[model samples]
Target: MKKIFLVYSFLFSVFIFGQEKSGAKQFWENLQKQCGKSFEGTVTEGATNDTFRDKKLVMHVRNCDEKTIRIPFFVGDDKSRTWVLAYDNDRIQLKHDHRHEDGSEDKVTQYGGTTTNAGSATLQFFPADEETCDLIPNAAANVWWITLDETSFTYNLRRIGSDRLFTVKFDLTKTVGTPAAPWGWKD
Candidate 1:
């Protein structure tokens, strides 16, 4: 009687939550085609005369499929490191692969990504044992927030674990480029 009702209620809640997650994923799917191509910009670290600036940070994003994305990043014409993004059920997952110039894996970094129903996605990088909740212990991590618009995109990053709150923002407007291929419908 009461036990059966409790089980049914739990099942209903699970189903509703699953649908809500699917809705969030669908939003990302809609932009799969347009997310490809290349973006180049400068990346700055630190401040003042000691500040390190890499103007050759090339960001190449490719739409592998409706469920996967690949971004290859290079610093100062180096071509051995890359950041990979692939769909993990309703969310996106990020992987950092460092390699020698000859293409051997030097190190591996694991990162996580999540996208909201709104046109915003976050990529978070941390140690595997670290906890990421806003409350409870408050572990620090490197975070990137990307907000998309029909004609432009905004990228912001925050580096945690420091006494100073270090933040950077890049505002870019879309330029002329070939149209993105249709997902699932085109080759």
Candidate 2:
């Protein structure tokens, strides 16, 4: 009876913790499915300025690996932005890597945060970290999130203390040809 009870307890523990890990793992895998693919997006909300108006917005899953995925975002002909997602320490981290045409890092780059909770298999949230606070004080209260479902992927950002909000959605059911490398990346 003792042996049977111990086995059952061990299995139960594995199921509980495994489910948590699988939730994140599944999300990563779902994203990996888009490797080497490109999709066009539109600013569905919070486009209060001309920055995103009447522009061709594209996101490319340029690089992918077990631990990291690099996605370059292109606005018209500008190739200065990339969104990097990394999995480490049992958490998913989101970072923005910005560069200039000369392949030089921007003054405001590599600012993001890690996942604070076990988000669902199709969604994850990343609140601004200390680095973001130091780099962009006004954006200290940012919360960025990405949601992936069967038909779409949405990238969103909101500042907790202000009315700042940005959201872009891509259609997953259709993919376009991959664009040229971002400003800082080599072919």
The most accurate candidate by lDDT is 2
* Residue-by-residue lDDT tens digits, candidate 2, 104-185: 9999999998998757789999999999999999888999999998888899999997878889999989998889999988
lDDT of 1 by residue, 82-167 (tens): 55555665555545556666555654434334543233233323232233333223434555454444443333445566643333
Measured with C-alpha atoms, the lDDT of residue 46 in candidate 1 is 45
lDDT of 2 at 11: 96
- Local error of candidate 2 at residue 170 (angstroms): 0.4
**Model 1 misplaced stretches (Cα beyond 4 Å):** 1-27, 44-54, 111-140, 151-159, 163-187
Worst 10 residues of 2 by lDDT: 17-26
Number of the top TM-score candidate: 2
Q: Pairs clashing in candidate 2? A: none
Candidate 1 TM-score, C-alpha based: 0.54
Q: What local distance difference test score does each model get?
A: 0.46, 0.90
Candidate 1 all-Cα RMSD: 8.8
